[model samples]
Target: MKIKAINGVKDILSDEIVYWQKIEKTARDIFRRFGINEIRLPILEKTELFARSIGEATDIVEKEMYTFVDKGITMRPEITASLLRAYVEHGLQVRQPIQRLFSIGPVFRHERPQKGRQRQFHQVDVEVIGAQEPQVDAELMAMGQMLLNELNLDVSLEINSLGCPECRPDFRKKLIAYLHERHDSLCDDCKRRIEKNPLRVLDCKQQGCRAMVQEAPSIVDNLCSACEEHFAAVRKQLDRLEVSYTLNRFMVRGLDYYNRTTFEFLTTDLGAQAAVAAGGRYDGLVEQLGGPKNTPGIGFAMGMERLCLLMQQQEGQQEEQGGADIFIAALGEQAIAFAAPFVHQLRKLGLQAAMDYSNRSLKAQMKQAGRLKAGFTLIIGEQELEQGRGILRNMDTQEQNEFSLQEGAAMLAEVIAPDKA
Candidate 1:
């Protein structure tokens, strides 16, 4: 039998890797500007970490997680729990009152894969630990919005309030009552979870389940004074920044930890995976996950696969030319030997340079340079080497110029260096 990548998982080949790098680079640059440092957590963590933090009743813990049998370890289906483990384990809150950390990595899930969803998917998680103010929530949301905007993605922001432990009891009571009224009509999964996780029905994708919950009471109207005020203040901050958004009452995110504020960045480009990014504020999670007494946190996560899917939908098979700024083509053995050091010096001077070592003919080497889409080709032939000169051929326009090999790095730097304003 021929070996192959498992179903629902696909490899990101070299040709498609440029887009991934561009996405990662854009995120890193924006994250730096926000004072959010990167945090790398393990791919696998104790099953108890997720079970206790994300809620054992949640679908992730009950169905999707890839757990081991011998020991109680599981591949992380999400990052928040692992990050919280690191935070509490390292006592990060003691070092800094406010911790802004982000991570981009693969997360495992055992689920039916479709267009964007996968068995092994990547998420860019941004978390702000040790903050309770609504502005922090708004700032995280704004930063996420800014990232998608910078990527030229046309996505809409939807925000919701799930209330806090103080007020959530009344809300859940009302929600359960409404759901119980339509219990018979609810989907099987919805029926089983109605009394336990009734809010989940609102976010359910099943058509029957969605129709049943449409007329159900909105959580917004049920928010208590403190939760209501926080939601109002968050909206006020967003309005102050002129960040347009819709108040989505149905967005009770799929997690037990999320409370007060939850959000999703939705895109119509991808079918089932509409949410390109989603996150919320979890106030009790730190305490729930055995952290400090009361460590508040807010964060958002972007699915790389979904984002790439949307990007590809917007921009088709246009290849980004991944090439050096200069390609050195040497004619003979002696010419090639001289070209190697020349290329190295150009690299040392911060120029992206490449050369043919096999001594391919001048015509063939020039063809290789053209394939690389190199900006300029420094051609060193037997004659040029004896004269200490190389013909520089422009890849774009079939123009050629001569330069001294002794002045290679300096000479190339002068040409490729960005112009001063």
Candidate 2:
């Protein structure tokens, strides 16, 4: 039997890897600018960690989690659980207060795949721990906005507060009562949620459930004095920073631990999966994971594959070209021998250089160079090799220039450098 990758998983080929690399590099650079160091958490974590942090009744833990018991250990489906574990087990114990960290890696969920949804997909996550100030939330939001802007994506921010523990229970009680009154009209999933996780009733995507919750009480209206004040402060900070957002009353995320500020960046182009990124303050999450009590934190995670899809759409709009700076073609046996070292030197100088390793004829090498879309083609013939010189032909203009190997390499380097040429 031929084995194949399960559905909802797709391999990223070389042609598409550059898009991810660009996104990763940009995100890393921005995080570094914000003084966030990288933290690589394990792909797997204890099931309880997620059950506690992400919430046991949510779809992630209840329906989507790829949970299994191994050697008396329970493994979970998502990376956020492992991330929280790393924070408590290592970050708090080893690192200083107010740790700012980011992680980008694959997360798993047993879900049906569509255009942007996948069973296994990558997420660029940022977590700011130990900061209770609302400005931390603003900073996280700004960072996310900056990343999307850097990717040239036009997106809208939908922000809301899930209220704090001080108020959430009262709200949950009222919400559950209200949902129970409409229990007959509620979707089956939401009917179950009414008993187990009533807050998620507001997050139900089903049409009937959404309509029921639409008339249901809003958490914003039921927030305690402190949660109300905190929510106002977070909004004030965001406004002060000029981060535009729309207040979404029904924006309670799918997770259980999220509190106070919750947000999602929506784009209309992604079809039914409009949210490319979403997260918020999970102040109780650290404590739930057995960390410090009341360790306030805010963070966000972006679906990388979805971002790449949006990026491809943007690239299509821009109609950009992707190609290397130089292609080196050899004409003879001696030329091949000489060109190999020359190509190496060019690459060592941080230039993208390729040679026809198949030992094809000069005409065939030139054709390959054109197909590779190399900006310039360097030709090394017997005479040119003997003279320690090469012919550099501008692929676009078809204009040729004779230069020594060193000069040709320098010219290629200058052409590749943004500031130099």
lDDT scores of the candidates, listed in order: 0.88, 0.83
Cα shift from native, residue 182, model 1 (Å): 1.9
Worst 10 residues of 2 by lDDT: 69-78
lDDT of 2 by residue, 213-245 (tens): 777889889888888888888889889889999
Off by over 4 Å in 2: 1-3, 72-76, 91-94, 315-322, 386-388, 405-421
TM-score of 2: 0.92
Which candidate number maximizes TM-score? 1
317-417 in candidate 1: lDDT tens per residue? 35484677889998889998887887888788777889989988888988888888898898888999889888888788889988887775876768755
**Model 1 CA deviation exceeding 4 Å by range:** 315-319, 418-421
Model 2 residue 222 distance off true place after TM-score fit, in angstroms: 0.4
How much is 356 displaced in model 2, in angstroms?
Answer: 1.3
Clashes of each: 0, 0
